[model samples]
Target: MPHLHGRVAAQESVFARMSRLAAQRGAVNLGQGFPGTAPPAFLLDAARGALGRFDQYAPPAGLPALRDALGADLGVDGADVTVTCGATEALHLLALALLGPGDEALMLEPVFDVYLPQVALAGATGVTVPLTLDAARGWQFNLGALAGAVTPRTRALLLNSPFNPTGTVFTEEELAGIVALARQHDLWIISDEVYDELYFGPRPTPLRILAPERTFTVGSAGKRLEATGWRVGWIAAPPGVTPGVLGLRQITSFSAPAPLQAAVAAALPVARDAGFYDGLRAGYAARMTRLASGLRDLGATVFEPRGTYFLTALHPHWTADSLLDAGVAVIPGEAFYARHAAPAGLTRWAFCKSDAEIELALTRLAARPELTDV
Candidate 1:
């Protein structure tokens, strides 16, 4: 057998593990983040109608129309947008452009799982600044830790607002501090804003809006339109940084699928699309409430979700694997953190499940009296 690279050969993702377990057990899965719904009817119609529209490869930077739509949506110019396979690809491209061996990237702990891997794939060291878990303050960003984490070797700051697992939205005041730190350290800001539109409280300000020159922002239609399988996303960078992204794109996947690009372009929300934003928020908010309420009734300490489809709750001693044995599957929160530590007793339940799926999960969980005894 041939040798394999350590980083590339790492074990299957926690998602893959939990999903396989779910299949084996036939458990009601809230373990993975896949949304249960499809995109709005208009978006689906656009895709279905695009069957024979454009058969050739999209431009390496993406379909020009899709780029333009993303530009307008992001308050940037079309020329500044580089569409990629998905937000994950966009972030990896940013890391490829920003970091290399000996460089250090700063990120929050319990990050979206891919952040660290992307940093590693860049051959960069990832330094984590944790968000403090405080009931009074909610999950608060620790600026002091961020300030302390910076060193001369720090090359980038990877940030995710409306964070996963915690669901804490980074406020303007917090961002102002981050901006100051970035300015002081001359670090590139690779902001993952995939869940930005899902905010339940105050809207989050994209880091690009605050520091366009130094920030590369990533967004995805997968989350925005609930069409993960379509894999349409864009990286909005300042004019100065886009050439590097384009260069990376040319050598990579070359371009996203054509029909999906056109479909996304057609259905993307513009300033006039009030109904799209309103309806999206209302639907997800209802799901979050239902899931959070259900978990609370089970004596779990549920953190009210501020954004995204995930609801984080504390389990006294339950592992997601054990939960699968109980016929319910949720992601064990420890999987999100980079460093090994005692499990935080947290489980992130994806409320993106359909109403029936959610009810089934709740019903199964409710019958497990061992859950509430904790």
Candidate 2:
């Protein structure tokens, strides 16, 4: 066999590995962040309607209708949007387009697992800035540490909010500090806002809104619509950067699935008019409360998430392996961090599951005397 690229050979997604283990062990699989429910009927209907007509390859940039719809929803110009296969691909495209050898990208610690590897793929150094967990404020990054990480080689800053693992939605003050740093350093901002609509509090302010000239914002139709397999996402960049990202898109996936793009276009207006986002927040808030309470009952310290359907808990007696054996699957907190050691006993649980699945996971944990025994 031909020798594989080092990056490809070295990469093993912990999510895929754990999901497989959970299946083999018959564990209630909270290890992956995918929703267990079907997408809404309106979205399915739109997909069906488009399947016959929009099946051909879309323009490399994307279907104009979908781009317009996304623009309207995101408050950006249609020309600024380039739809991609998913947010993962969008991030990869941005990294490749904006970074190169000897360049550096700053990433906050416990990043979405893809950020560091994508930076590496671009032949860029990824510098980690640790985010400390604050009991009252949730996860916070120090401006001083972030400033120290920037140098002449720094080209970009990658951020995820309603952040994965911790689920900390960046507040206005935090975002302002980050935006200030980006301006001072003349760095591009790649903000992953896949969970933008899934927030529980006042809607998150997109970084593009704060610093449009310097930010490339990533969003996911699949995440918002609960259709992860659809693989529909977009990058809303400033006009200056749009052409470069679209050029990269032509070489990458070329274009996202045309029918899926049309379906998302058709569904976006309906979702907005029907108050779907409000219901989504309410449902996830209830689920977060249920799961957080359940974990607390099991003697774990649950950090309540303000946005995103994930919760992190600290428990001296439980680890990912132990929980998997107890028939409840989770990802160890350490899997999310690139350089810093995660707090001892911290584990991330996906609450994207249904109430029934969450209860079953709780029951499985409660039944294991070894997990609760201090």
User: Which prediction has the highest TM-score against the true structure?
Assistant: 2
Please report how far candidate 2 places residue 130 from its true position, in Å: 0.7
Candidate 1, residues 193-286: lDDT per residue as tens digits? 8897888977888888888889988899998888888888888987677887899988878999999999889888642385687678888899
Scored by CA lDDT, what does every candidate get?
0.84, 0.90
Task: Name the runs in model 1 displaced over 4 angstroms.
Answer: 270-274, 340-343
Could you tell me which 10 consecutive residues in candidate 2 have the lowest summed lDDT? 134-143
lDDT of 2 by residue, 224-250 (tens): 999998999999998767887877889
User: RMSDs, each prediction?
Assistant: 1.5, 1.2
- Top candidate by lDDT: 2
lDDT at residue 158 of model 1 (Cα atoms): 90
